[model samples]
Target chain A: MSMRRAEKQLARVTGLILLALVLGGCVNATVDEMTYNEPVAGIGESSVVILGRRHKPDYDTEFDFIECIGDHIHSGDPSIEVINEIAFINQFYPWFEPRTAPLQPQTIDQLLQLPPVAARFDEIKLEYMIWIDGNTENTESTGSMSCGIGPGVAGCFGFGTWGTESEYEATIWDFTDKVEVGRVSAQTSGQNYMPAVVVPIPIIAPVQGTACDSLGDQLLEYLSAHH
Target chain B: MLCFTLLAAGCSTKQVVVEGNFPKPLLDPLPITLGVIYPSAFAEHEFFDEAKGRAESDWLVKTGEAQVEFWDILFDGMFDEVVHIRDWETVQRRAAEIDGVLIPAIGDLQYTIPTHTNVKIYEIWMRYEFRLVDIAAIHQQEDGALSFNPDEHLAAWPITAYGKTPTAFLQTDEEAVNLAAVVALRDAGAHFVTSFGATPDIAVWLDGIARREQDAALSSSDDASGPQPIAQSSETSSSVEREPDSGGTL
Candidate 1:
């Protein structure tokens, strides 16, 4: 082949290789799919209501898991009345003591607008309320090294470490005769981090499902058997 | 040229390990009950306010509906769960159970009829307070506060600026209030949850950490790698272009 032709061929090959490399680097990350087990039986027929809220927008995954558990129970036992609505948790409800601030009529109106399911149920009655704590630890380490220019012929650099912990509480209430009959409380903790990195790539960890399922199951079973 | 090409290829191929660990909620089937209660005057307020005085009550109904929808979307989006109701009495009974029991309160209303214009801007401020009650410990825990300023949220709108019809302004304000409430709830929830415990479910814990790191990174520096970047990416990417560019060299 002529010298000019060979050079052109080499350039074409190099360009193709570069294009492929860049395309290969593209990645799309997503949360792993979760699996759930069937609800345990022997609890019998009962009615239930749950009010829960997550402080963070992304924490909906937790509620989804809880709902899945509720669905399982409803599927297994037809007589069990399960009314789970995040709205009832009253995200607007004040948490401070002395409770001086007047409840917003608008907020009350919003709650009232929800389906009147509570008024119809007679025998079994239950309510669950959840709150996510914010005092968690978080850490991250990132560094980069470039062999050419700027600093030196050969150079290296890196840093990253973060930790945070937050609290969450679930309050269960039983409504019988328009009164609270029972209340159960539970709490859990969580922590996570991203190790050191040289590039600006996204780092996501594999998350294993925790005890939320058991908590949901236990709450349902308790309501079913009791009420 | 060959050496440079080889080096570039190597750099691109080098895999930098990135790992993260956090908490996730467990999935367990359970039966639960839910209830929704509203003041008896809700319907009357809507009909009377709309039919008689300035028709502001229609706006109230719209605002109420929007608020409910907003909460439904917000919770559904965050928890991946749906609130199902078997009956409405459960909600009334629940509300009645706490009838005398004072809890963290929220709600206030103020209306101003402009002297010059025929428009009236009703400012609705919805606040939420959670009295962290530790049932297990049988003691009242810490309390958190969150407030929503709907006026500030809607101040920049064209309708509000130009003094549009009360109906139009009311619609705008209603939308604004709904959005503001969602934000307030999120903040209040975070504040309440954090005050009670330092740890959260594994998935939530990790997510919280990621958010904190992101916030720290953002506050410390304006670099794109900070926490704000993740938020922007997640929020803005919904409208991002997916098609690849195709063109000849200029």
Candidate 2:
């Protein structure tokens, strides 16, 4: 082959390799679900509430993840009504506050025995309450990038990578029966990359988003299933 | 020049004004007219902390508006009628018409940021001193039946509340701190409503009011049904001893 032809072939190979790397970043997610009681059928008129556990002093289940799960479940099944987290919590006020929220199904039953609390719950027609606990964190990280500017020229040249993990569990409770229905959990890990050659190109791994999607999908399946 | 400007901007004071809507608590109202006193210091409360290090920024957090709003809603929901008094003088002047008076003051306020804790979170803590004044006692003094003494007709207690917000989604430290403060204020309101009339001092004070009302009702009633005992408020009221107001310190 001629020199010009060889150069063109080498350029094509490099482009294909870069495209593959950009399209396929390192991401892994696992989802598990267990059911203790059968879900009630005909949930068209009932409502579900998704709440984040915030009692931990070190960390809290992020609100955005809860919202993501709500949105996903609603999208999956339009018949199921999802209540806004803030609005539902505010309607109940102190009973559902961080410090006073019921941590167990039995506690919820006792709270419901209160006339005022029971009246409000009846008004809302709540059926299912999902308590989400866990958070995304940077488990490990290595490498660093540096940028410098001198005289008339300025640019960045370095490479860095960081690992992130997200683990979340959704505990579903049957509000009408006051029993633990089931639980669905998702664990996800990913590595992010940054390569700087004059201009830094970041390849971000969607660790949290993947975890939310997996948990949401599993939760939707668990709720929709009867037996 | 640009670096100097950036440094100056970094050193500028961060002012956070807490703002949010506090919901009315769902509970049976205590059957009593309450006179609320919002001292100027409590109503216009602000916390200021100068940066201790070069990397830190000064914070001036104004929580007065939210404080007044939260307490107003809470008190209005908890009592049969809530009367906002401008000062203690007003409470003294109209002591006869009111059943009791409530005065809330900030004892202490503290906060933390992600840089300080290395935990990517912002937290705020508040201590509130609440004084429940017996209007009947004040009314007696006002009627010239007894000597006027400010400390003789009151019971005071302290409540501590805490709140925190994660910095993952927040774009700025000011926003995080503001959110944290709002959460803390809401927490304070929640604590007040759930624990009111349960604290040892406040419970005894409430029990005394209940007994007085019961006696008054029995004397004035021609029939058997005089108001029933407040279930939650008077449950443990008689069991606890009332603590004297020791210089208004809890």
Cα RMSD of all models vs. native, in order, equals 28.1, 6.8
lDDT of each: 0.31, 0.78
Q: Write the per-residue lDDT of candidate 2 for residues A1-227, one digit (tens) a residue.
A: 69998577557544643753675366899888887765657476888999999999988898889999999988988777899998988888888889889999878877877778889999889989999999998867665567998889988765566788999989999987788889888999988776666677777789999998899887787666431
Candidate 1, superposed: residue stretches over 4 Å from native: A1-45, A53-81, A86-159, A164-166, A177-187, A196-211, A224-227, B1-178, B181-250
Candidate 1 CAPRI classification by DockQ: incorrect
Q: Which candidate is the best by TM-score?
A: 2
Reference-based TM-score, model 2: 0.84
Residues A119-159 of candidate 1: C-alpha lDDT, one tens digit per residue: 32322333322221211122333333233324334332232
TM-score of the A chain in candidate 2?
0.85
Judged by DockQ cut-offs, is candidate 2 incorrect, acceptable, medium or high?
A: medium
Considering every candidate listed, which one attains the maximal DockQ?
2
What lDDT tens digits, residue by residue, belong to model 2 across residues B155-203? Answer: 7778899999888653688888888888888888888877886788777
Please list all clashing residue pairs in model 2, or write none if there are none. Answer: none
DockQ of 1: 0.01
